[model samples]
Target: MADLVYYVAVTLDGYIADSDHKLDWLMAFPLGDDATPYDDFYRTVGAVIMGAETYSWILENSPEAWPYANVPAFIVTHRSLSIPEGKNITLVQGAASMVAAQARMAAKGKDVWLVGGGKTAALFAEADELQRLFITQIPVVIGAGIPLLPVSKVLNLKPVTQKVLKSGAVELVCDVVVG
Candidate 1:
């Protein structure tokens, strides 16, 4: 079975994005490595899941034409969203477990990327479906913003890998000890 990995960038204070849901703060960081961590991770991911807002944000902001053309993407949303032509992106609304199951099926033994804002990621974590978490800790502190993991409950994670990226970002890869 493929592990569900929560790959996300966060501020030092543990914020994923600003209140406006902007990742501009993360984009400005200097990536010193020639190889991108995302590219390597993307190869292992067959499916991606995110919240409605995160989906819309990527649609509006991503410079690429189709970032996940080959990967299946599931967006949890109540509101209708515009579909990008020739992309395998689906809008869904349901219990987190349902979404996780669908994503796992789509993954076909590959990994699932639980990508999103705090609340959406929290949903998977709460369901105990998210097995791994890769946190790119950028050296910044956003006083007020969307938290990295916003859950009423706590999930314990044990570090499997930790390294300082060429971009000066601290990457902490952890196995979900108890989700």
Candidate 2:
């Protein structure tokens, strides 16, 4: 079975994006190298699960070619959104448990990446499908924006790994201790 990993770049104030659903602040931070420190961890990802808002945001912000071309990507959306031709994107509407099951199949024994939208990740967390959280915390505090996890849930995480980047960001990998 593939594990669901909610990997995100968050602000010190626990935000993934701004109020207007922009990541410009997060993107402005220097990454320093050609490849991020998370590259090794990302290499194991086989599929991606994201929310409708995240999907729409990516469509608006991403390059001409979809970034997750090879990776099987599933978008959780109740709205009737159109997927561009030649893109391998699947829109699903259902409970998180059902989506997680489908995501496992799509993952093909590799890890399933919980791509974006904190609310969507919260659904997975509530379903007990989220196994880990790899959060990269930037030094700056934006004060207000889209939260890290909109849905409230107590998570007892056991630290598995940690890394501090040259850009003054700290990345922490932890196993969610599901109780």
Candidate 3:
């Protein structure tokens, strides 16, 4: 079974983006570690699932034609969207359970990454479907924006790995105890 890992960057107060859905705040910080972690993550991720908000944000901001060129990505959205031709992307519309089932099926041997905005991650985390959470805490704090995680409930996680980068960003790897 593939573990669903939520890998994301958050601020000190826990925001994924600003009010305008711009990640300029994230870019303000000096680049911390290289793509080693992302590379390692991609190696283990056979498929990825993300919220519409996050997907749209990347589509609008990413410079590359298709940021997730090789990898298969699924975006959960209510609105109809035409995924760019020749891209390994899918659109899934349904409840969290349905989405998880589809993502798991696609993941097969590798892991499924829940790359997203707070609602998606929080839903997976609440459902106990999110197996692991790898958060890279950047050394910056935006007074207000989208929070990294939802403020609805508390999630109990066990620390498995911890690494502090030279740029003061700390990467925390934790396991989501799902029954």
Candidate 4:
């Protein structure tokens, strides 16, 4: 089975994006030497699952083409959205378990990248569908913004690994404890 990994870059205060739902703060930082972390991770992803807002952000920001064109992408959204032509993207609405099952099948033994927007990741985490979390902690603190996981209940995580990047960013990997 493929592991559902919520691999994302977060602020020091645990925000994925600012209040405006923009990544301007994150984009300001330069990718220091050995910036291949994302490329390395991307090589292992076979499928992707993201929320509607995340999808919309990508569409608006990356107008030229879809970033994850090679992988099967699933967008969890209640609102209607259009998929770019020739892209392997699916718009779905349902329980996280159901959506995760589809993503897992599409993953074909590779990992499922949970391209998140907090709410969506929370759904998977709340449903116990998320397996791992890879958080790249950016140095800045956004004060207030979208949380890393906005679940009402507590979700335990076991640390797997930690690394400090050349850019003073920290990368922490953890396994979502299933109880």
* Top lDDT model: 4
Please give the CA lDDT of all the candidate structures.
0.86, 0.88, 0.82, 0.92
Q: Which parts of model 2 are misplaced by more than 4 Å?
A: 34-38
Model 3: how far is 147 from its true place, Å? 0.9
lDDT of 3: 0.82
Lowest-scoring 10 consecutive residues by lDDT in candidate 4? 30-39
Task: Sort the candidates on TM-score, descending order.
Answer: 4, 2, 1, 3
> Per-residue alpha-carbon lDDT of model 4 for 1-179, expressed as tens digits?
89999999899998999999988889998758755467889999999999999999999999998999899999999999998888999999988899999999999999999999899999999999999999988999989999999997898999999988888888889999999
Tens digit of lDDT per residue, candidate 1, span 100-170?
Answer: 99999999999999888789998888988889998889998888899999877878889998988766778
Q: Per-residue lDDT of 1-179 in model 3, one digit per residue for the tens?
A: 88889898888788878877888877778755553456877888888899888888888777478777767889988888868778889888877778888888877878888988888888888877888988888878788888777836677789998988888888889997655
TM-score of 4: 0.96
**Model 2 lDDT per residue over 75-124, tens place:** 99999998988877899989999999998898889999999799999999
Give TM-scores for every candidate, taking all chains together and pairing residue i with residue i: 0.93, 0.94, 0.91, 0.96
- The numbered model that scores best in TM-score is 4
Model 1 residue 171 CA deviation (Å) reads 0.5
Which of the two, 2 or 4, has more lDDT?
4
What lDDT score goes with residue 34 in model 3?
54
- lDDT (Cα) of model 2: 0.88
What clash pairs does model 1 have? none
